[model samples]
Target: MGLSFDYALLNLGRRPTRTVLTAVSSALVAALLVCTAAFVRGLEQSFTGAAQPDVALLLSRVAEGDVLRSSVQAGLGALVRANVPGVAVVSEEVHLACNVTVPGSDGARAAMVRGVTPAAYQVHDAVTLTEGTLPGPGEVLVGRLLARQMRVDPSRLAVGETLVLEGAKHRVSGHFAAPGTAIEAEMWTPLEALRGIARRPDASVVFARLEPGADARALQLFVDRRLDLELSLLTSEQYYADLARYLAPIRALAMAMAALIAGAAFLGGVNTAAAAVQDRIRELATLRALGFSTGALWRSLAQEAVLLGSFGALLGLAAARLFLDGGAVRLAMGAFTLGVDGPALALATVATLALALLGTLPALLRLHRLPIAAALAED
Candidate 1:
């Protein structure tokens, strides 16, 4: 049978308010889906991108997965370098999660403070010295995205500004960037200075870079041989992978909210479609009596659903561009920007159309087997 959308197009005009409401409901669901997809994608990309395949962390197993709580002997780096054959360089780094204040700013903000040696530059090659100079005894250098991650004023972290940490003042020496990594939100200072500030002689961890093609199993074996060290070997990839799993609940929660809104949209679509059929029973019966095929009638209903879905998809994309795109979301590790890329947009659009198309099922079934004689005789 031939299909036509002329009657479907005209039907939408019969009750303009209902048509608008149905489209708006679909838009809300689509907007939630697009934003959730963007959030989940950005979160995974940032966490996974931060990992280095060959670098390993030597930390106390007691600290579990928290690097900030780890404590390894300061001399462990030297021992590892001497014992391990393929070890290129080892950096004894300290990680401190603490609050900091700007000299003139009133409130304090949380910051990730890392104490590093010059060898850290060799191990963490992803880091680059972008501006000013290396941090000296009483100064610190910040990452490029530190201000945004910390939600502080850019001037407060400028090259020449002073940052207060635990009642002590330290100058901001420079800002560096480690693209696609969580490292770009921390403040780095000299190891010796942080040792004095934190009043702990132990280093947080010994981050070691292995030579190309070297096995990380050797590092674990080294730890195994010396139970006295109490150090556990964790590769950078393993650390980030564990971090992503820990944060999985957050992504699930976002998708769950989107699913709830989608259910609401589906119900709205069904209500709208059922109402349209009920209002036009007599008119529809007349068409059936006049020789219009059941396939043509079903196609017309499908057309209306598609139109609503398409319009709503576009509206949702517009909402995502206005609100979620380029938006920063803060997490325990760091912050990442929500990106509404092509894949996210496409997925959300498809979901909207599918939900709309499925909603026509009940209405189509009723109209398909309608008793034309009774429908025409009714008031």
Candidate 2:
């Protein structure tokens, strides 16, 4: 039988307020889930890219979430280099989650600081010196984004421009960028600059870079043999994965919020669909009496729901991209940018369409069982 889609369209238009409410409800939920999912996934990317694949990290397995809390003697940095044949380079770097005040052209704001050795640039190849020079004792290299936020030029941040770190003033010597990671939002300094606060009697981790074809497992075993020192060995990838695991609690919380919001949306959608069908019962019954097949009626109802849901999905995704993109939030790893990637938009659309399918089911069944004679006789 030929379909009269116009009939369904006219019915939905007749009840404009209810239709609009349903659409708005679906849009709100889809937006929340999309933005939250993007932010959580973005945090993962920020930390993962910060880690170097060719590098192996040495830390205490007993240490908790903070790498700064993990301690390996400074001597081990040298020993790991000398003992491992495949190792090409090693450095003892210090990392802190503390905040610092930065002076920018726009004004001053608080941001995270990262202290690293000169070899940090070597291991993290993407860390390019964009301006001025490398950091020396009592000096720092601010990240490109952080420097911009602080309104200070790399070259202009003269040797005497005092940057207070945990109440101690350190000079700005250079500026750097880590391309696409959140590290670019932090300030870098010489490991010695944080001496008193970091209490680096021991280094946070002994970072070693391996030569090509060198098996990380073999190297891990080699370092694991030094369990007497209670040192745990891991490839940089493992360390990144561990960092993701460290942020699992926050991720879980994000997922929980998405679930709650999605659940409410689903329920609201069902109610809206049910109300749309109830209000149109007489018209639908008239169609049945006039010889429209139950299957045809089902198709029309499902099609309308899909159309409404698709509109809501598109609206939600657009909102996320326009409003939430590049939004930053603080996490244990550091502050990370919220990413609204293609996959996230696709997921949000699919999820909303699925909910539409669910909402359409009850309405379809209600129309199918109407008695043609009674439907036609009804006022």
Candidate 3:
């Protein structure tokens, strides 16, 4: 005979404290799993989504993936504009990944400084000035999200504030925003001023916009054939996509840590389940004597574990939604919001259920080994 649904539920209530503790432990594991997965996935999406599909990024052939390390003659922008067909706009840019000390503090934080011209505004149309104006020589425009990325006060990045970069004092001319993109974490300065400060004679990358109806493939091929230029071309979308792949190791580490945490939680749950089953041996043996099949006994216990897991998962997801969702996590590359999207929630659900069933296995094995008469005779 199969146990009634009420019978399974009542079993959990028989030891309410144990049941609550186990569920809470599982909930913590679920929260950790969801947050970790969401953080990595959000970072990947933020980076890959930053690229505009209508533009192409030209990098030095020697530094294909490392834009900060790449250097191409500043004059190359003019050359490309003059020679490359279907190119409507060309913006020369210099990128440097450096650390800057916070104002009035000895603490330092990493920052990406970009040297750009007015043409850059046209190429990256998503950027919009929120305060003050575009940067002029000796001035810089800070991304609206830069303060958050650097984990500093937003007022420190306000217009008129000065930030020392490479030992050069540069006033913050404005604040700009480019939501959901890596650009939101960068600081922009005038091309000439940044070159002088960074002591670089060349630009890091060239951005080119294609005219409507123009063939991106043909433009890429044209750059590829320019052996004298020694340049590599990638669509802006492809560039950010490549950047996401470059940061895969960090994401992998996050996933591994989440797995380790979940494994520990699972072990804790196993111990709880084993103790609960040990206490209920006589009850289970009495059911067996009442014509309950072994499969029915197993199913009843499994149902209880799953029910506990489901409740825990709900609590964990709620906690994550309240605390983690939309929260920004800063990395070496930039800041990405923690996303508790559908996939992350679904994964948490599956992990919770799996842990519930797998964690109960030891208890089930112990049940199978107990002699019916001996189990019922226990005090």
Q: Model-by-model lDDT, in order?
A: 0.85, 0.72, 0.85
What are the models' TM-scores? 0.89, 0.84, 0.87
What is candidate 3's lDDT per residue for 129-211, written digit by digit as tens?
A: 99898999888899867888888888888899988888878899999977667788899999899889888989999999989
- Residue-level lDDT of model 1, residues 1-379, one tens digit each, is 5446676788788888888877787787788889888888887877787778889989998999778889989888999999987888899999998778886667888888999999999888678989999999889999877888878777888999998986689999998877656787788999999999989799999989999999788898899999998988899888889888988999899879878877877787787778878888898898899998776776788899889889988998899888888777776647776779899899899989988987888888888889999999877
Model 1 off-target regions past 4 Å?
118-134, 178-180
Instruction: List the lowest-lDDT window of 10 residues for candidate 3.
Output: 98-107
Residue pairs clashing, model 2: 103-150, 104-150, 104-151, 105-151
Misplaced by over 4 Å in model 3 are: 98-102, 107-109, 125-133, 199-201, 365-370
lDDT at position 359, candidate 3: 83
Pairs that collide in candidate 3 are none
In candidate 2, what are the lDDT values of residues 67-183, reduced to their tens digit? Answer: 767876767767877777888877777777664544443433455666677677778876888877787776777775664444446444554466666666677777776754667
In model 2, the Cα lDDT at residue 233 comes to: 76
